[model samples]
Target: MPTHPHSPAKESVVDLLGMLAYGELVAFDRQSIDARLAPDLRRRAQLSIMAAAEMRNYQRLVARITELGADPQEAMEPFVQVIDGFHDSTAPRNWLESLVKVYVGDGIADDFFREVATLLDPVDRDLALEVLHNDDHSEFAIAEIKAAIADNPAVTNRLALWARRLVGEALSQAQRVAAEHDSLTMLIVEGTGDLAKVGELIKRLMQAHSERMTTVGLNN
Candidate 1:
């Protein structure tokens, strides 16, 4: 917004962009790989299309980082470890698990990014919002998960537990990121302006997450 933004604000923007860009890259990779676990050609093709969307978003974000005079790779490097760790720890062991991860994990990720986008300037905020996972893209995964639970209600328990693990791992990585990146953390704290508002934001996110879970016949 300013001709010359404060150093911390600028750095925080770069950091957030970097994190988001890398996240899109990783999302593409995961979606591509997870597509292999799909039960049918149609489902696999759907996931492949979703994966391509993520790559396109990745390009947009990297271009924005370069326009800002930051090296996209360097901007993304600090987050690599934690991001990779999240995927490593939550690798889906089956087709259903992969679907659940895509539905729950990506849903929560988009919600969090949408929340963070509010802290950014108009241009960056729009960019951040653009890269968010589209619920339409997740329709296949959501339908599959819901169908599975409908056919076999007992499946809901296992999937619900898996969903919880995904959320927990995501939150853990977020905490690590906030601790390691001062500027980004400052942006969030300053943007929220108070702990009460921050808690409220969390409540909204959790509520959205719970509704998504319910849609798939899973308990939050």
Candidate 2:
């Protein structure tokens, strides 16, 4: 592992990477499980392929953690309980719910990391952006959701309600993680150069989330 000129920033970067790494790992697991919920073999296979992509992203993050001279598992440990708790509390009961979780829940998280990645140094920023869910994944989810809603408008209200719950839980978990990790908080504050910008950041995330909901024909 090479030494960084800014050790504190390095620690923050490690925290970020660890969180993302665990996220990718869990995404892979969740997608594999949720694929079983798919109504048809085609959708199941498509989801399985997405799960494979997530695993590959996890491997990349783990390799980066190793390059930073940190134990990948150790770096990821701090986030395990929180991430797991979020998933446990928001477990999807059906195929549409699973797709909504993937689209809305995971979409917000990806937006968040993309925003934070801008504050990182060049190499880390690029890696972070590179590992996010691809456009194809988002398009697939949107298409499935829209098709479902179009076929049966009666399901719209229920799915919208589920999306609301997901947003609430995701925000709560994000706050918990930030509050518990001082280095990460400091990184954000320093990067933005103003504590107030953090509030603005949350607003932006929410706005993007709303747009996504609207995109899928769901009410925000």
Candidate 3:
């Protein structure tokens, strides 16, 4: 087998990296907005910290894009519609729902990224891993969800429905992202395939998400 140099991916690689960076940036923005829905200052701050991490990660991705001769904004432009749409359509109806979306949505996305990261070169792989939420931030969201449920048992039904809606919107957005963002999707396709691997990857994401939801006392 011929060993290829780790030159920048053709346009495909460039576009994929751009989409991932933009996705991180938008995720930060949306989470910051949704964080305000938190009931108190502490929880809000925790979410803000998570968003800040994303911005830092975005900077790193942009720097890498520049290194590869791509403009960061140009790299990110193609993904605005699908990313923005998912957040817009899935806007939480309340504090608990917002938490569910943050914890639940972010959890699945991170898992997907972990899978994708493995397929990248060391630098890109490390970048993908670095973009994930820290354990403490995740714990904060989880703790808040548990506390909210504990404090108001009546909220379980409402929050469960809201959680379901968030997942549905998230899955829809993922499909759109996959269809529109070829480079990242190609990474998956290369690792898995057109059919079975993609389905299985999504299944793992869904399963992991379901387990997380259950851990927080939400129904699937």
lDDT by candidate, in order shown: 0.85, 0.89, 0.78
Q: Which candidate ranks first by TM-score, i.e. highest? A: 2
Model 1 stretches astray by more than 4 angstroms: 1-8
Q: For model 2, how does the per-residue alpha-carbon lDDT over 1-220 read when each residue is reduced to its tens digit?
A: 4344333478888998999899888988988999999999999998899889998889999999999899999999999999998899989999999999999866887888799888887778888788888889889999999999999999999999999999999889989998999998888887776789999999999999999999999974
Encode model 1's per-residue lDDT on 1-220: one tens digit a residue.
Answer: 5653522277788888899888888988998998899888998898899889988999998999999999999999999999999999999998899888888777877888899887777788898788888778678778888788878988888999999999889888988998899888888877887767877887888899989888877874
Residue 43 accuracy (lDDT) in model 3: 72
TM-score of each: 0.93, 0.94, 0.89
The residue pairs found clashing in candidate 3 are none
Error of 1 at 172 (Å): 0.9
Task: Provide the lowest-lDDT 10-residue window in model 3.
Answer: 1-10
Backbone clashes in candidate 3 total 0
Identify the runs in model 3 with alpha carbons over 4 angstroms from their true place.
Answer: 1-8
Using lDDT as the measure, the top candidate is 2
